[model samples]
Target: MEKFEFTKPELEETEGILNHLRDTINDTLKPDDELRLREQLMKAIEEGHIQRDVFGLNPVLQALRTAQIAVDEIGLKRDGVLATLLFPLVINGHQTVDDIENKFGTSVAHIIQGLVKIHNLYEKNPIIESENFRNLLISFSEDMRVILIMIADRVNLMRQIRDTEATEAKKEVSEEASYLYAPLAHKLGLYQLKSELEDLSLKYLEHDAYYMIKDALNATKTSRDAYIKSFIGPIEEHLTAAGLKFHMKGRTKSIHSIWQKMKKQKCNFEGIYDLFAIRIILDAPVEKEKMQCWQAYSIVTDMYQPNPKRLRDWLSVPKSNGYESLHITVLGPENKWVEVQIRTNRMDEIAEHGLAAHWRYKGIKSEGGIDEWLANIRSALENNDDLQLMDQFKMDLYEDEVYVFTPKGDLLKFPKGATILDFAYHIHSNIGNTCVGGKINGKAVSLREQLHSGDTVEILTQSNQKPKQDWLNIVKSSKAKAKIRLALKETRAKDGLYAKELLERRFKNKKIEIEESLMSHVIKKLGYKETSDFYKDIAEERLDTNTVIERYVELRDHDSGVRQAESAENFEYESPNEQFTRKNDDVLVIDRNLKGIDYKLAQCCHPIYGDDVFGFVTVSGGITIHRRNCPNAPELRKRFGYRIVKAKWDGKGSSQYAITLRIIGNDDIGIVSNISNIISKEDKLTMRSINIDSHDGLFSGNVVLMIDDNSKLDALIKKLRTVKGVKQIIRI
Candidate 1:
């Protein structure tokens, strides 16, 4: 409404800027705004303050150099902005700039140079780790100007790339900029850069969809613009009529935002109606910003029907990322839903640029400073050794953020995909290792359960319990994943050693000599890829002691065939259960003869006479028998479990007993024939269902038979072992 004017020094700087920007750049600054900025600059200079280099160089001096360079590089068209932005870096750091220029050629600008430096620095330590380091980098900022310039440089590139012929390449650049730079810009409160980068990037990455929506939007633009103008006119009129100083502006949604709505709602372009929005900026004191916003909302809704469900009150508390605005969707004229965002201009700037814009506009507030977030990002970059920092950063920036609560109600934010386990681990490694379970909002939940916002979680821990291997499946944080992996590995190593000691103690108690050489063979025979695996399996109760000992014996014998005879000396079973053997008796006498010379069950199978039996000579406990289908059969076949010695019944008659066959049936009739078919197929032994009374036609029977030893029993039982109804064969 006023004519543009500037002070002497301000006009001088303006002329220099205009000389460079006149033909090339579109000046978005209104005439009045330009004169105001120039006047402010001159006033600040007169008041003995000057814009300084990031290193504190006087702005007047920097401007002078920048002006000269812009004049020298005036003919450079495509990357003119870039060159102007770079002049400072070239002059300030000659050698460094020369090296970069040599490597990338002179075409690269100072802003690009700064970007490359920051990029390389971030690339070097890409993971956002220890927030401390990031804070240290920022808090020690000599001038903070370099970082600001670098950010501006990226924004300019984002804009410049859009106008280039390499549209596809620029699209990729924009996407990356959005993922990394835009968030950074927003985090820093650089709203101008943030909005432009987001809109431009969204345009290229999703062009067709963007334009389709854009066209649909354009079709309604005229009517919608008029409608919004008419809708807001009364509010402006009412505020003006009330003598309240305020600024009202239209807020259009970004393309990326519109596309997200279409994707989320599964809607066509035509389905989207509320594309146009409004923002009400008020001239008010900091304390009155909220009150005025509410007053404005009252004015808006009073004139038009408002959707209660679409009302969002963010003025009470801003986002952790520093976004604040009050949003309301109103049913405007023609029954169309029109959204409005209400904030102070300060709030609007912060919403758009984030922390960077805050720095430019209001400086940093001590309570919510940029150092805090930057420190977090830095910490993530540093502590993440398992992942490349770039990869972690890419994931870190793109991931949706979740907010959890500390025990004291303070917020603990994590990536969206993080789980309770991650939350526990994030608190402390000791807390994580001891964490057994957790309560989400006073309700007990699994550690693997995904966490959500507003969840007040309390981790349950066991003082003695360690992390379980299954935690690997559910943990999502890079830190948690790495810590859990380390803990599991360390625990497994300890368990393996414990298992080895246990086996050693068991052998020592029995006076069984298994040399370390033969021990390795036993470990390998257990199908363990590593000795540690074998030991851990034993400690975990996954491997049986008998199998290990027996394997050791077999390997010992194989290594030296001469040891075959010595097997008898090593094979001694001093069972605490058996007391029938008399003192000084070399072998127990059964039915008047030494039982050692008579029929015996093989210990490998522990088979009874009626069982699919096998027998082996025990070095001390006479002879032991086992079922032919025993788990030890494979090893026995290879070593001595199957070393069946032939013997006959002492003619003292038959030892009629029970031989149990585990029958697993489909709960159907004639399940016995299904079982008996195999027994009948064997033709060597007769089996009767001791338990099955043939009721309901589904029978699970145990066949009983008297036999000499395991001679033909193995073959007969092997055949029965294959029966359709027979799930397992155990000699009882």
Candidate 2:
């Protein structure tokens, strides 16, 4: 790449950033190391064009400035600082991995390479895909400092997005930041960055909402400031008299959060009352941090009446993201609700910067707390064995979490909507496989029961109660789903082996060698796509033994001197009248008196009772009922005109017809139960079974039902369609 000369203003800005970087790294980096890094960074800058400015700073300078922020604010080490400075060069395609490693030693080069890979992966794949998202995290896992640097980079990007000219591109960046990066930041406990990213994203993605909130805040700034000041006055006096050293500041809710509240509460900006919060940062000794926090809490609550339900004491048990604080919403001056937060200086740092500050302040490696969270993510990525990978990963990312305890008082964390089955799997795969149900707080609950925080759970299991394929649809955790799939696969493999052995033995007794060619023919005749499927069907007794034997014998005979013409003369066929008279327990009884018309539901349209349907007589399968508007209906009506039979529901048949319905909705806890309750409440309807598949917050399922008439079925569907969260319902 050709080097471009820096303009006068660009040069001044670059120098200023470089000076700031030096000041930030003054105490951390060794003299020789600092000199080498400075030289390398200057060389890289000289050899590349200042293509763009990020937040009014040149890209190269912005990277250095970000590195400085990581060092001073986030406490990244020397290697992290060096890597951040060089990452922009690698990302912009101005430098190669080999060039970086040869010039900047192995460690710095490795970090740069990891950052570059993450950047490229984000560019190539949608962030919503679990595989790509997991890969992004895995890349960061290699070097924890890479996460810090990325956070810094995002902070700078969010700061600069307002200057982006292209509306579409800006919106795209905002959405990604809001959905992916912001959540990641929150997970890491980087509350400051998370809030900024969310606010900036909202500014672009929902410009009108953002400005409306912003303007509302500005209009009330004077009054809010006065309220905060008045509210803090008594608390300040109490703390001062008690000999406590502290500083208090008023904080306003972020634009994004305010917008979220409006949407969730279905209220306008004016309806939002607790828009401003008060923070009291105490300079407490390390050993007395907890005690001091409580003392401060007492002082504040004593001055103002506190809402017991609104109190959150993270000081007793910090959040998983390493945030520690005491929060209370109190009745403030003028009878307004004022939110108050109390934390020590150290706790405040961790609350702002998250895990990075936690490590820096504690003087410990950033592994123990964050590693547990990362391990969960890594396991999800490594063990994903199904098509629901994206959904499972997203559930981990976006869902609120609940912490529950075992009978032994051991704490476990799960997603908010996780059921007892998920808790079982979290205990052990064997436990999950054998789980029948469980007790929540000594009260028996179904396996599908959604657990709440602080519940004491005891799983009930039986050796004979093995994991069913349907369990995959019931559990909410990736671990539970993965274990179920593995168990099902193993069971199928064993059954397939037994089936193959049995078939081979039968073939041997018949004086026939089951060659690969013969097996292929058998699979085709059995209407199976794979040999394994054929064996599995046989093992499950889904394929009739006599049918398999007869088909194999006919195939063998035809391969030899015997032909179809010779077999036709010897073949005994049942009369159409005899076949038509065979009773089916769950078949649709076509017209009131037309009881003996043999028919099968057409797979093409899967006609249900409520569907407008007609029967078509076929040469082999007596009659096939299809929905009137089925894709195959028009052709069947035109080509098989004579075979078409006019059919209508008599609405008085005693027998019930099996029908399948497709349902889609927003995934929520107890959604299946809600749907089931609706079906079970109807007097004439019986639900045969249901299978649900969900990912993210969306669920799609198939419900099999037995109904007597089209009108009743239609009424049932109408009731189901009205259920909360139900988006679409149709006969499948």
Candidate 3:
């Protein structure tokens, strides 16, 4: 590689950036370290360790600009800035890990290594989708600082790509930024970077929409400023009179945000009313911060009519990523809604200058989920459980959350809609497995009770209690749901083993050598679709031991032709080759090889022909066929897992399934008659029942139909959806 000469402008720009970087990190960068940084960087540049991007931008200048962004914007210190500046050399293979570790400290080297690893993964321009998203998190989730640097570089790239001619490449980069980087920025509390990334992404992807919103804001700037002034004037005076020191400013919402509102509400740009917000940052001591913020909030609300639902109180409990503020919306001048944010200067610094600054501050050891997740990562790294780490990251990345308290007043946070069972599992898996119920604020509540913020709960546990399949539906947190599923699997395995032992004992007691294939044939003869199903029934003592053994002997002897010859006419052997039929005499072609097994269709979800279906063996009622996507399938599979089996319709038969459809539509005169007419006109379809209810000009009804196959049902549904007055129709 040939080394390129530095132009005069490049050197001048480098000199300015070097001065800025040194001043920013002056306290931490010693004299010797500063000299080493300048020397090593110049050496790398001279060694041809850099190349210009496709836009033909200078790599050294770009690296310096990225470092400046990290320091000035993200509040990254000496190590962070140095790693950002030196990462390019490693990427170009001019600098090795050992060299970096020796030149800088271990921290800088580790950071650069993470950066290089991510760069290698990004060489193919991979956008992290569902298949690869978890891998991204597990590999780099522990290196959050590295991810932040990557985000900063992406922000710079998006900024510089505006006039570039790489159309397709730019679009791919923009989509990746929107899908991954912007969301990570929001999660990390980088509001400024998050907004910039989003706006730029919109600018590239939806160019016309972005400029439209931007131009609209510019057009209304004069009137909007006047409105903001009118709203803030009295509030500023009121705050000064109350002896509070504060500065107030107003800003319009981001263009991307405005675009999202337009799409979400199905409205035009003019329909957006709350386009701007006023923020009041108070200068107060650490101890008096919350008090002063609340006082300002009161003063603002006293002057304006505040919307109760729009209030968000984060001062009481800060966000997981260390965001603290009180936000409220109120009706300002011209009866227009305006958002107000209240926070102290310290809080504003954390929100603006850096998200990690608050946690890195001297006295703060708390960053609720980050700290917990970091600990989880350390253990996961040791155990090498990539999937578990993925689950852990997913659990913590939920944006909307609910915070609750234990009896000891320890605050715990969970995803919104989390139940008391989730709380118990979060406390401990053993406690969750044995949790019977809980007491919320001195009132006894079931485990299914949804938790609310600030509610103190005490879990009640019993020794005999165990996790049930229904618990999966009760808990909303991923952790609790995962634990319940694992426990159910383990329980099923243990039961299967115990049942195997018991059956072996019975066979030994009878002095009968067990024949594996013959026993399997006997199990199917008893209508068990799975070998485990047979063992499960025997283990639960649902089947009589003597009766099962005698049947096995009869089937075995009959198979050998001795019992068949003894009584050819009166032989009671239930042949395994018997065709499937219901006791009600509804003949269906179920298993092709079977001749006389009793089975019935599940009424909950009618298993029609050409539909995906499965079989579940019943205790005394033989086999029950059900649709694979049946509403009750998850619970049945979780609890009675061993009883589940695979079943398919071998061919069409003389059987009709009763299916129900719930229809909602306009309560027009005789609208129900139209729906009935459509169903009646279809060939081989019969309306079994029609229950209709009408109110407030809308009608909802359940109509039962007898159909032979899924295709007919689907055709009927499509025809019903086309009805004039029908709004929606779905099968139940």
Query: Which candidate number has the best TM-score?
Result: 2
* Stretches > 4 Å off in candidate 2: 1-3, 30-57, 92-94, 358-693, 696-732
Task: Give the best candidate by lDDT.
Answer: 3
The alpha-carbon lDDT assigned to residue 454 of candidate 3 equals 55
Determine the C-alpha RMSD for candidate 1 after optimal superposition of all C-alphas. 21.3
Pick the winner on TM-score between candidates 1 and 3.
3
Residue range 246-365, candidate 2, lDDT tens digits: 999999999988898776455689978879899999999999999998999999888899987568878987766677899998898788888899999999998887756756676653
- What digit string (tens of lDDT, one per residue) describes model 3 on residues 1-732? 555666898889889998998886677664687788778777877777767777767777888888888767766677778888888888878788789889788878988888887877777646543434445665465565677788888898889899989888799889888867877676667789989999999999999999999899999999999998989999989999999998999978999989997874457899888899999999999999988999999999999999875688989988666779999999988889899999988898778744555645443332232344334324333432343333333344444677778899898888877888999999999999999999887778898787866578899999988788778868888899999999887777777899888877887898877788888888887778987777777767655454466557766777878732333433232233332222232334585366678787776677787888778766444787878777767755654544556677876645677888999986655678888889889988899999877644567889988888899989899998988668898778
User: What TM value does model 1 have?
Assistant: 0.42
Candidates in order have lDDT scores of 0.59, 0.74, 0.77
TM-score, one value per model: 0.42, 0.58, 0.56
Rank the candidate models, highest TM-score first.
2, 3, 1
Better model by lDDT: candidate 2 vs candidate 3: 3
lDDT-based ranking, best first? 3, 2, 1
Q: Considering only N, C-alpha and C atoms within 3 Å, which residue pairs clash in candidate 2?
A: none
